[model samples]
Target: MASRLAQLEGPIDTVYADIYNESGLRKETTLSKELGFKGKLIVHPAQIKIVNEVFTPSKSEVEQARKIIDAAHKAEKQGKGVVNLDGKMIDLPVIKQAEAILEYYNRLVINNQ
Candidate 1:
């Protein structure tokens, strides 16, 4: 399903792991994150908090994203479009993904505040 979504030319921003049980949902959320899912689908209102907490990027993740974005920007300022971030070459696509993650994290923080 994730592969199919990636094959589409248009963007598929989020994927939901349709689940209900607490522990099951927690496990599913973890797998979904590994699979690049940005949200979860829940059947009950009680699942809302769990889903949100699971989907929100962790503090460490947000910090990593900030570092990636900063590195990319620094590279761009130096007339280089690609950067080696922790031994991996980061270009436009990687930078875009980092930007997206930070954007989502920022939105969540703003909404919570």
Candidate 2:
């Protein structure tokens, strides 16, 4: 069900994890993140930390997103519509995704600070 939800291109912001079980919450949150759910519903304050941790982009992900944005900018400057990074083609959709990731990461940083 989570996998199917991930397939939807529309925004997903209402998935809920097990509120009574911490372990179950962790697992469910992690799986939801891996499956591309944007956010999860949490009934308890304790669930906030785990849910945020699962959804937050990692250091490596931020770095990769920066690289993708840089590569895309370079390609744009060169009048090219696509670029290659780490031997993989970086197209518009990939660039957009990377930009979105960075945007979300930046928001997290700002909010946390």
lDDT (tens digit, per residue) of candidate 1 on 1-113: 65646674222233334545678777777777777666665666877877788878889888888989999889989999899999999988888878888988888886779
lDDT of 2 by residue, 8-63 (tens): 54345564546668787778777777777777877778788888888889899999
Candidate 1: which stretches are off by over 4 Å? Answer: 1-20
Error of 1 at 51 (Å): 0.9
Q: Which candidate has the top score in lDDT?
A: 2
TM-score of each: 0.75, 0.79
For candidate 2, give the lDDT of residue 82.
92
Which pairs of residues collide in model 1? none
- lDDT: worst 10-residue window of model 2: 8-17
Output the worst ten-in-a-row residue range by lDDT, candidate 1.
8-17
